[model samples]
Target: FVNGKSLTSTSGSTASQSTFFAPRSKTPNRQAIALISDHGDPAAEIGKEEAGGQNVYVRQVGEALSKLGWQVDMFTRKAKADDPTIVQHNPHCRTIRLSAGPEEFVPRDRLFEYMPQFVEEFHKYQAKHHYPLIHTNYWMSAWVGLEVQKTHNVQLINTYHSLGAVKYQAVPHRPAIAETRLAVEKAILENAHCTVATSPQEADMLRSLVSDLGHIEVIPCGTDISRFYAIPKVDARLQLGLKPTDEVIVYVGRFDPRKGIETLVRAAQLIKRNTVDASNLRLVIVGGSDPTKPDGQERQRIEQLVGELGLAEHTTFAGRVGHDRLPLYYTAADVCVIPSHYEPFGLVAIEAMACGTPVVASDVGGLKFSVVPEETGLLVPPQDETAFAAAIERILSDELWARKLRKRASERVQQNFSWTGVAAQLSDLYRRMLAQSIMGDMILPSQSAISVSLNPDALPNPSR
Candidate 1:
């Protein structure tokens, strides 16, 4: 049984018996970083039909790392038919898109067949311009990262943003993707040089589910505090076509059932009936999916829920809002609500706090780490209708207390999650892996040359 090893699924128990990861001394660090993800930036411009948190995380990390003097190149699959091959994000950060299989959009569940091609393409690019090691995001990219490791003998850091077994158990019926996901995730934990988790909850998860074979660094994600600074309450209301008199609660992310938008709808219903004070309360849902499209089934489900709740007038669906405009929504809202059933790390909470907006988030996953209960924000039991309504009402009724919470929330994020600080930590990880003791079996006893044959079938070195 796969149960005996250090690895377990998201729904599986964290093993009591685990191996500890010993990081070889902090070293010099790598000059260039190869960031890998199946979907997310710098390859795709977000705020489209199917982009969300993962995209935001990768792009910000890349841009932030670049600013700290490391050349960051994000490598990802070209998942769309007309997507560009390369997108230059900043002077130090760039994304190079390459062929994985069919040059078309395929649900990630079926992309396993094309990964060999992905590994080949990565090496081909590496041969052209030397990159020392790689940092892969998500389980799919982790699979490719492991395969490439055999040939490149390069350092790897795997970030399992979300786990499948945990998600599947929550669904009424498990999707076909669930069973296979368990396998790929295990392979990653057992082999990768390290697994970077954004929160301690996720790091604890790695120790319990996967082999504690390597280091699991808990690096919390940061926000653009400068952009989200407290806006004049009156000015913010005008910017979003809102009113000083109206009480608004906002949610931001792609439409997905796992996000528990339906729960928020239900909680909103309860709040409308129960709260005498927030009678003019409005809930706004923002994302990239169009409720009218066939693939946007989740968005349609959410709209249907809104209609069923008879909340047609109390709620506004703002379709998709880009990065440039995200701060406006945060500033205008009375509070930001993150009601995900589970999150590897809650980026939304940090972003909202940076705007000096207090949050009402589900007490699950990284949300617990991002928000402090009754301090910066209130954390309610996930999926509990009454708890959500009460928390919402409490924040709205107590303006003085809410303002104080917002001030502390902004300060906490600035102290811990600045992008520059995160980049330095990552840089240290890269350098430590370069030493002979840390690079695994790559360093031989005597003078040696290591040559990597960029996989078996790939269009090697576009320049070559």
Candidate 2:
């Protein structure tokens, strides 16, 4: 069953095999579409370096779209030699890893040079299995989509997972490829059929920093409600071996400086020093990292800071928690903290909230939209250790208020951030775009033919 609904055969045949395992011919007619995530492999393990929200977003969207009768083909660059070329998530959805530069992991900043080869590989695939509509993720994939559109009649839709214009503002230094990235991001916005912004703040950023000419839509990143939901605190704590009195604060994401891990660490220091009976306070940092990689180095720095701040005894680095086990951590926590310098959308915040845990996130980007300040959770200024400490302390100090926040948080997510709901919105948008393309084609024979058909009434309401 998908989202509490079962699939039934119209013929009412009592077949030996389940309908789920039926051949492609027996399946319903499905629209073929491509989702290109050049650097974010949809099938990659989460919490790893460069494998965070974008990876989860693509994979979840693909599977959810498949349930709505879309044959989803997710494309990504092959970063590892031993990894499979294709990973089938379901009968209708699969991830296609294409070879570009080398069969080794390369940082996103350096991956731009390899996009030409990625585009060529995409062309070869398009020749064999044509996709009339393609949605591209990130600036690199946007470039590929634009290039493919030059040769094919494919309708292009782009999602800027992280815009360089917004990201570069937070960093101390710019990368060598910053100019190229900025240019590509702007070009995609002005050229693609539409650009999807995960938050209204992101859409505003595109208008102010990127370009105002693009058709922008606000569709949020979603979480699997089936996977993440309220679990009894006692049960979750018992499963994770946590003390009943412990005031647990959990941070789940990549170990990057931009993610503001240091701020959370410092906030823990403040919580310990200022609060009475804070001896039972515990900080659980959950994410994957390699010692040699950038994120690993950041982890090392954070660990050293935790030691210097005398938080070593109170802190636990729970390496990498898988999705199956992640909900337990969220449910067990007293409060979840997301101290990112910037987030287009904070997937961790909603995931934790869905598990009936209050969140203390930075008041930046999409966190503003997801976490309803006093109603669901608290939002503090980004990188402000004092503010983060105060916010987290509020949740831990007042059990009744926290409980209220928990219930409202879960309800908010169920009403707005379910993967099934998100996919339905995207399906509507895709159908409308396809219809507009067909309409444009049908009118091409007229003397007063319009090059494009963009009826405002046909567009999905951003307010939804």
Candidate with the greatest lDDT versus the true structure:
2
Candidate 2: tens digits of C-alpha lDDT, residues 1-464: 22223334343332221232233456455667899999999999999899999999999999999999889999999999999999999999999999999999999888988888898898887876667689999999998887787667676899998989998986678998887788778778877787889999889989999876767789999999999999899899999889998999999999989899999999999999997767899999999999989999999999999999999999999998899999999999999999999999989999999999999999999999999999899999999999999999899999999999999999999999999999999988887666555444332232122224333343222122
Candidate 1 TM-score, true structure as reference: 0.85
Q: Can you tell me which runs of candidate 1 are displaced by over 4 Å? A: 1-30, 48-50, 277-279, 291-295, 436-464
Would you estimate the TM-scores of all the predictions?
0.85, 0.90
Off by over 4 Å in 2: 1-27, 441-464
Q: What CA root-mean-square deviation does each model show from the true structure?
A: 10.0, 8.4
Best by TM-score: 2
Estimate, for each residue in 115-186, the C-alpha lDDT of model 1 and write its tens digit.
778888988876654555688988888877877765554567788878875676677877666666776676
Candidate 1 lowest-lDDT run of ten = 13-22
